[model samples]
Target: MVVDEQFRLHPESTAYLDAVRGMGRSVNTERNYAYGLALYLTWCDERAFSWSDPGFENLLRLRNWLVSTPLPVRGRRVQPVIRYRKDG
Candidate 1:
């Protein structure tokens, strides 16, 4: 498991990732999940929300934030910024 100094994942989150790896998940998939969960944790921390116990209303707020916020795309070339859009 890679240790990131900037963001420390909760023990349960680490164990979950390890389990996913033990299940033969691809490295790309594991990495993607780790990155995504890390981002969510960071967001929760910033908003003083408990990651393990964010209430339904808090989850809705998170959804709203995610939908409105622009996310950066990573690549070798110029990365585009995108936001999550909810489809009705």
Candidate 2:
């Protein structure tokens, strides 16, 4: 069920999800893949890179960005939350 900001199905990602489901991958695993793909796609869009063929160097840059950037908070915070913690 991966889609873009336009709410259209990303055909390739949807196909990939279908394949993994056929192979008996768990729902949680599929969910993780979907979100990761979405994140990568969004990064590509923001940086004006072609998601289908971002160069290796750009991908390496993305790896660096992943560690350097603080992830967005998941929901409205009722209390103080630590920044950049992988888990809390």
Candidate 3:
């Protein structure tokens, strides 16, 4: 339930954030979501995406960014260092 100083809620983000929180996420999890989403939006800044636009390449780039992020654990950097995997 963290809100920015301007108090504007991003409509597209609420449902996903709530779903993750409902799964018993902690404060750190919330922070991660916020950080990741902020970066994602920044990446999308000059690009408007839609089915009628320049295909789905931007969507894949966002997915790639998520896949490359590593989660910290007990002072160790673990392998398979990604949030999600693409099915082959």
Candidate 4:
């Protein structure tokens, strides 16, 4: 089991990560989830928001930020665009 410093500081997050591993999830999947959670915590810290109890508005803001944030890949960066469709 790999222990990340940030996860150590956030016990709840560490427990969640441990649960993910206990579920027989792949190491890569676990790592990805950990990285994602770390990013969320960082975002919350930047805004002095409570990561454990983020309100709906804050969640929406986080979603918007995620959409606009570019991810690095293969020495290049790519921004993910999400499109919503209206359906009956």
Candidate 5:
């Protein structure tokens, strides 16, 4: 389920995930969707847009930001994943 930094369950996200799960999606699918929702909500929060109803322009901006920005480097203790990004 999606959660904030404080570790509380996100109500809307949890409900959505539950619905998807009830439809027979796998736990892996739930995890992936949860991650994506967290990213979208966090982006909306940073830009002071209402997460549920960000406007079309705001959504376009989010799309642009996602393509332009590099993904974060994630690592395990034994190995790290390296991603290369191209700049416009």
Candidate 6:
């Protein structure tokens, strides 16, 4: 079981990660998706939530969180810039 700085450990997670890599997933892709899943699980634990919850909202929230993480490219963290004007 590999525990990163985030302190998440699951041997099953390791097997899943290895399976993806064995199937020719890029190292970065495996790393990112695995880390994201671990983070999501941790979030669920903190909130006392379960994957069995019959709701799509939680899944949507996870997708949103993934998009919100800055993507590293060309030695930089880049994200699509969005701006909204406050109307009073």
TM-scores of all models?
0.76, 0.77, 0.47, 0.73, 0.76, 0.51
TM-score of candidate 1 to 2 decimals: 0.76
Question: How many clashing residue pairs are found in candidate 4?
Answer: 0
The candidate 1 region of ten consecutive residues with least summed lDDT is 79-88
What's the CA error at residue 27 for candidate 5, in Å? 1.5
Compose the digit string of candidate 3's lDDT tens values, residues 14-81: 67788888899997997789777766655565465432243477777767765675443344565444
Query: How well does candidate 5 match the true structure in TM-score terms?
Result: 0.76
Q: Which structure is stronger by lDDT: 1 or 2?
A: 2
- Candidate 4 accuracy as lDDT: 0.77
Which candidate leads in TM-score?
Answer: 2
> How many residue pairs clash (N, CA or C atoms closer than 3 angstroms) in each of the candidate models, in the order given?
0, 0, 0, 0, 0, 0
Model 1 spans with C-alpha error above 4 angstroms: 1-9, 76-88
User: CA lDDT of 85 in candidate 6?
Assistant: 26
Candidate 4 ranges with C-alpha deviation above 4 Å: 1-8, 76-88
Please identify model 6 stretches exceeding 4 Å from their true place: 1-8, 51-57, 60-88
Q: What is the lDDT of residue 7 in candidate 6?
A: 63
User: Mind giving the per-residue lDDT tens digits that candidate 1 earns over 1-88?
Assistant: 3335755547878998999999999999999899878878878888887889999999888888877876666566565656465622
lDDT of residue 54 for candidate 2: 97
Residue-level lDDT tens digits of model 4 in 46-74: 89989889999999888887777655444
* Predicted candidate 5 versus true structure: per-residue lDDT over 1-88, tens digit per residue: 5456778887988899989999999989989898889889889989888988999999889888887777777766465565644543
Candidate 3 lDDT (Cα, 0 to 1): 0.62
lDDT of each: 0.79, 0.82, 0.62, 0.77, 0.82, 0.66
Tell me the lDDT of model 1 at 19. 95
Kindly give the stretch of ten consecutive residues in candidate 4 with the minimal lDDT sum.
79-88
Sort order, TM-score high to low: 2, 1, 5, 4, 6, 3
